[model samples]
Target: MNLSANNLCLSVDGVDHLENVTATFQPGRLHTVIGRTMAGKTTLLRVLAGLEKADSGSLTREGTDFLNIPVWRRNTAMVYQQFINYPHLNVFHNVAFPLKRAGLPRQEIQRRVRRSLASVGLADFEKRKPSQLSGGQQQRVAIARALARGTGILLLDEPLANLDYKLREQLRDEFKTLFSDQGDTIVIYTTTEPAEAMMLGDVVLVMHEGRILQTGTPQEVYERPATITVASIINDPPMNIFAGRIVGGQVTVAGFQATHVSAHLSDLPDGAYQFGLRATDVSLASTGVEGEVTFVEISGSETFVHVAVGESPFVVQVEGIHDVALGDLVKLRLRPDRLFAFDEKGTLMQTPSYGLASVEGR
Candidate 1:
């Protein structure tokens, strides 16, 4: 089922929650909405699920008006950040509740309950109450419940946010695989984490302050963020931005000149601009731009070195272990092709292109 929202506007008690928000969710695809706290992620999801009404605009499913439909009749299932399960009900009944509500046969309900439970790794705990399960387990039960509902639309509002890091990672993969083959369901997932959005979303919508700033495939948005705000929210460690200027066909910043300029930047008229670089695009080398390593973080599989160059601080993500220590002087090297140039107004200036060469070192 195709879901579309047109010019959705909502406000409560004089505070605007959704402002002209519009988007279409295609059937069988997982759409992700990402934003910070109170950015209207929840409000938009509620509007889509029919839990909250939009003061203006319309929602439709294949030309059928959805706003006029009651919440229970919308045929949508939602899972929130907080675990929602009946403490009085055992795992089996909790997963079976939705099926039973639909008045399915006893054997079919049991079969689906077991299948959904196993999908979320809760098959062996059917007899246990939610109170007896760990927080992650309980959340899985909630997910299982949603899955068993067999709805055409699934709305998830940061459903995995409350789980531990390890479990979140595991469930992320599971959810991706589990939903990939569901060609008839339209899943809308909201997350504060960009990595989660990138991993799960076939289409990502970046939201801020009740507005969607950009919409595209994960790779398109990540590689070519439309504005600084989108870039800031779409990166895990965050993009490093520096004030600089274009001079003599080169970009200059922090007393270092970048010779490998993208051809799309030729029309910028040499002046003030902002430069963006991702941590993964930088590396510590024997000789390059110099910086002082102020902090070091070792995460078993990788290391993140926080370095200070002049008055600006930059982070470099390195694979595995490194010999660098705090307070060590290090040389930083950047891949020019990986750099992004934005105008002083925070709008991305460089057009999408490939195979750009770095001019000989300056």
Candidate 2:
């Protein structure tokens, strides 16, 4: 099933929820939509699932118009952020509900239900009611129900948001493995967390303000963000951005200078720009600007040090534990290959030869 959304536009009460959004969802691959709350992630999903009508746009499956078909008639299944299950039914019956509605034989229904349940790690909980299972287990039951529907398209809206931290992590791995082998199923997942999108999406679509900001594989988007907004949203601890200027063929931010000038900036008149670097790319140096440590966060395997260089503050991620303390002065250096330059309008200035290597080279 190839799903395509062409110039999709939706509005309510004079407010636009989706603005000319367009994308293609290829069969057998997981596509993830990532954005902040109210960024139109849910609205886009609802529109695709035929739960909401678009004011203007075209939706098609295999070149056939899909809007003429009713939501119930479409071969699509949805799992929401909330775990929805029939409290009165046991896990087996809950998963079997969709199969029964399709008029499958008793044996076929039992077989499909068992397979779906086992896929979600809920086979042993078939006899348990929703009230008797943990939140994660109940959510798995809902997933099993969707799987039992045997739909070609699966729409998941932050399905793990309701689970606890540990459970979410565990279920992420389980869901990844479960859906990896579904070559005929087209899965669309939406999430606010960048980490979740990177982990689950074979292709990721970044959205903001009802617009499709960027689309690519997770690695492509992460390594080469198209804009400053993308750089800020796609990172875990967030990229450190500083006010900068191009001076005499060199980019200068705070007290740090670029070791080499990028050809992309050769034509631009010297002016203000934004310099960005990931925390992991900033290394402690023996000879560099002195920064006062403002905060120190030590996890078991890594340490996050927040330091203030002059008036600008930046976060540094280091491996394992470090003896750095608050108020301690440390020297920091930026890896030129890992630095990003954005214009005043937040557009990324591409320098293929300046980074570690161009995308093609890698």
Candidate 3:
């Protein structure tokens, strides 16, 4: 069954939680909603699950009204950030709880429980309680329980958020295989991490301030962000944006002008524009745009230096650690082919050409 939401709006205590949101989900696909905190990801999911009613909207499942359905009868399952499993029940019984409540035959429940446990790599731990398993193992039990019932729609809200670094990585890899080949199931996952969204989602939805900003495939969204907000949200450490203008085939910022025109952007009409560049695409050079180093971050084998050039801020990512200190003057060299041009209103205009032909933004 396909699910669709249209013009959903919700507000509580004079604050808007959701605003004019519309999207359609098809079966056999995983959709990952990416946004920062309070972007209404949870609110939208609850509305779809019949947990929260939208103030003004229409929800339909294959053209039938979905809001009238009770939450328990919606045939949906949700996994929270916390590993939710019955503390007193063993792994086997915990996964069998929903099937038992639904009045499935004893033999059928056993068959499904075993299959689900094995799918999540928790078959050996069915005899253990939640407390006996480690954090990642416990989450595996929760995931198994959610999938065991054969629900039509599955919602996972950052299921690995509480796990350690190594555990998160391990589960992320596991999730890639677990969620694949979920026949006729529409899976929706919400997360704050861009990497998580891009890695797992068949289609990516970027949200902000209770609104859906952009929706596309992972490659489309990453390569062609609709707005400056999306470009920032889709990249780690966010994309660096600054005010500048292209005049007579020359690109100049408001202050500390140094870079030349981008080869792909030089043909565009002269006007004030915003440029978005990834941290990795920029570097420190002696004969380029100058700025004052405001912050330095040493992350593993890479160093990220934050610099303030005129009124624009930029983060330059370089290999290995560098001894960059605060208040240090530095020169930044930006790749001409890696810049994303935007209009004054922050809408994307033209994308850089790495290999694909640069196209005009919508």
Candidate 4:
């Protein structure tokens, strides 16, 4: 089933919790809704599932007006953060409950139940009660239940949030493969984690303050963020931002350009502009300007170091936890090509960035 929203909005107590939101989810692909807390992620999911009515907007599924459809007849199922199961019911009964509600025949329900359990690797635990299973297993049962009910659209609101990191990662891959194999069954999942969004989503949507900021493939969103917020959300350490200006043919970054963009240098008239540089774009060199190290965090794979360079503090990811300590003076320099310039309003500036060759031997 294909689902689309137009001018969708949901307000509560005079506040627009979800406003003017619109997007389309094609069948057989996973779409991720990402936003920070209070951004109306869950509210939007409820509206799509027909659990909550939008204040103003239209929803269509397969060319039919979905808002006109009742929740029971929508063929949409919601899996919540909490696995809601009848405590006394066994795994088989819990999964079979939705089929019974749909009035499916006993034989069909039994077949669907068994198949669903096998899909989530829970076939052997059909007779076990909910309390006897772990949290991960309980969530798998929840997913199996949705599948058994013949749900056309699956709405997951942070389904794996409460699981351990290892299990969460494992389930993420499993869920992606499951939906990939489903072939035309729509799955709308929401999460605030950037890594999860990048991993599972065929289309990633960045939302904030009740609106969709940007939607594109993971690489599209990361390589070319539509807004400053989108860039900030996609990167783990986030893009570094500093205030500077273009004055007298020089792009001053914290009062020092060292590197200049002369081709379209006159584009931005002398004024304050925010300089955005990712940690990967900046590096430490032997003969660069000396900056004091503020902090260092080693995470097995790489070492993240914060250094103060003039008025701007930059983060650099070194190979490993070296012998560097806080307050140590280190020579630091930005990789010219990786630097991104933004205007005062957080919009990216239109200009060619300097390349690594421009800074390496300069």
Candidate 5:
């Protein structure tokens, strides 16, 4: 079955929650929605589950109207950012509640409950209550309960957002295996993380300010971001953008010619362009494009040095800790060959590399 949404619009208090959002979701593929907070990821999921009504839209499942169906009758299950469980019910009962409410036979409920719990690695925790379980286990119970329904559509809205780093990582790894075997199910998972979206998604939808900016496979979205907004959203610290110019086959940025682009990007007309480069592709140099260090962040083994070139911000992500201080004048070596060219209106003009970006996952 395929689920389709066309011209879905919702507004409240003069703010658009969704702006003409349209997409098709096919069964047996996991579609990940990635965006910042208040980007309408939750709203989109709620509308699909028949929990929220759209101001204007058409929702169909296999060519039949889906918006007409009540929330209770829709074959959909949703897990939220918060772990929701019956306070008084143990793990097994929490998973079996929906099955029981559906008036399934006792044997059938027991069989489904057991398998669901096992699928989420909670088979031995059946007798434990949510209060007695850790945060990760509690969320697993919520996931198991959702899986027990065997719904056609499964929506997970940042289900691991609240977990600790280690727990989140652990569960994120387990989720790939758990959901891989789901038959004919349309799974829509939303997150604010680029890594999570890339690692788990069969198709990734990038959203911003209530509109879907771009949609493609992880590699497609990363290597060939459709617009400037998409390139910024899909990167961790965001790709560094600079106003540049190509004159006589030489690319110049901040009054410095970085590379002679006649070979790689030769066909472009001489004019103003926006260039994008990943922080990882930049490095500290003794004599290169100069900038003032504005901020320095040491994250584990990597150090992110934020520098200001003129009025523009540049980030250099390097392995190992560096002796970078604020207000320090630093030189940066921008890999001009890795630059992405964009038009003045923020639309993509060209990508640097098709295969290289995929290997490095920029």
Candidate 6:
């Protein structure tokens, strides 16, 4: 299932919700759609699943334009954040509903329902109603229903959002394995969590303000985000952005010495550029950029030190939880290759210099 969205745009009641979004989802891989609330991530998934029509643009699967395909004929299964199971129906019946709608023989529906429920680790829970199951279990039942429908494409609209941390993690890993084992299934899922994108996505599409900011592998997006918005959305602390300028291949911060990354700087003009560096990319040293620590957040394994470097606040991820107090004097250094530069328009200037060419580009 090679899926493509060409100039996809959508609006509701004359209000623009999604704009000019384009992406290709290859077969047998998980594509995660991530963005802040109202960023059109859900709307994009709806369009792809044929639940909502694009106001403009087209959707295609393997070169066949599917813009006019009816929802039921699209062979797309959509699972929303809310699991829509019938309260009175047992788990078995809920999972069997899709196959039932297919007008399958009773025996066939029973077999498919059992198989689907078993696939989602709910084999023994067939008789339990939605009210009898945990939130995570209900979600699994919902997924099993999609599988029972035999959809070629799966659309998950924040399906894991309602679960607890442990359940969410468990389900996420399960979905990852499900995609790996289910050949030719194309999954497009939406999430607001960057960590989830990093963990589960083969390719993560970052959306903002109704437009796609970037689409690439998790590593590519994390290390070579195509725009400031892309950079900001893919990291835990997000990337630290600073206003600066390039002069003779050297980038000078407002109150720090000049330096440059290994990224190709030839295509850029010789002055005035914005710089982006991730929290993990900044190192601590007394001789580097000076700052006054304003706050610190420790997460057992790492500590995020929020510092006021000149007039701007920047966060640095250090090795372990530190005892550095607020107002402590500190020095920060940018990792050479991790520093990303952008022009005034917020486009990422550095492409990934370390990886093989993208599968899409190939």
Best by TM-score: 5
Using Cα atoms with residue i matched to residue i, what is each candidate's TM-score against the true structure? 0.90, 0.90, 0.95, 0.89, 0.96, 0.88
Q: Over the stretch 1-362, how does candidate 6's per-residue lDDT look in tens digits?
A: 59988888888888889888888988889899999888998888778777788889988987788888888788889999998899999999999877877889999898889988888899999999999999999999999999888788988999999888889988888888876666788888899999998889998899898898888889878877888888888877878888876678665664664445245544667777777777876777766778899998988889999999888789989897788999999987765455578878998776434433211100
Worst 10 residues of 1 by lDDT: 352-361
| lDDT (10s digit) by residue, model 4, range 252-301 | 67544655654544566777777777787677788676689999989877
Q: Give stretches of model 6 more than 4 Å off.
A: 62-65, 248-250, 258-269, 351-362
Show pairs that collide, candidate 6: none
CA lDDT of every candidate = 0.88, 0.86, 0.88, 0.82, 0.90, 0.82
Q: After superposition, how far is residue 98 of candidate 5 from its true place, in Å?
A: 0.7
Can you tell me which runs of candidate 5 are displaced by over 4 Å? 354-362
Q: Which stretches of candidate 4 lie above 4 Å from their native place?
A: 246-250, 262-272, 287-294, 323-329, 350-362
Clash pairs, model 3 backbone:
none
Clashes of each: 1, 0, 0, 1, 0, 0
- Residue 169 lDDT, candidate 4, scale 0-100: 91
Worst 10 residues of 2 by lDDT: 353-362
* lDDT of each residue in 269-310, candidate 5, tens digit only: 999999898998888988777889999999889999999999
Residue-pair clash count for candidate 1:
1
Query: Candidate 3 — which residues are off by over 4 angstroms?
Result: 254-260, 356-362
Query: For each candidate, C-alpha RMSD in Å?
Result: 2.4, 3.7, 3.1, 2.9, 2.7, 5.0
lDDT of 3 by residue, 1-362 (tens): 78988899999998999999989888999999999989999999988898898899899997789988999988999998898999999999999999999999999999999999999998888899999999999988988999998999999988888999889888888898889768898999999889999999999999998899999999999999999999999899999998878777677763534345667787789988888989988889876778999999997899999999888899999999898899999988776577899998989899988874322111
Displacement of residue 38 (Cα, Å) in model 2 is: 1.9
Q: 217, model 5: CA deviation in Å?
A: 0.6
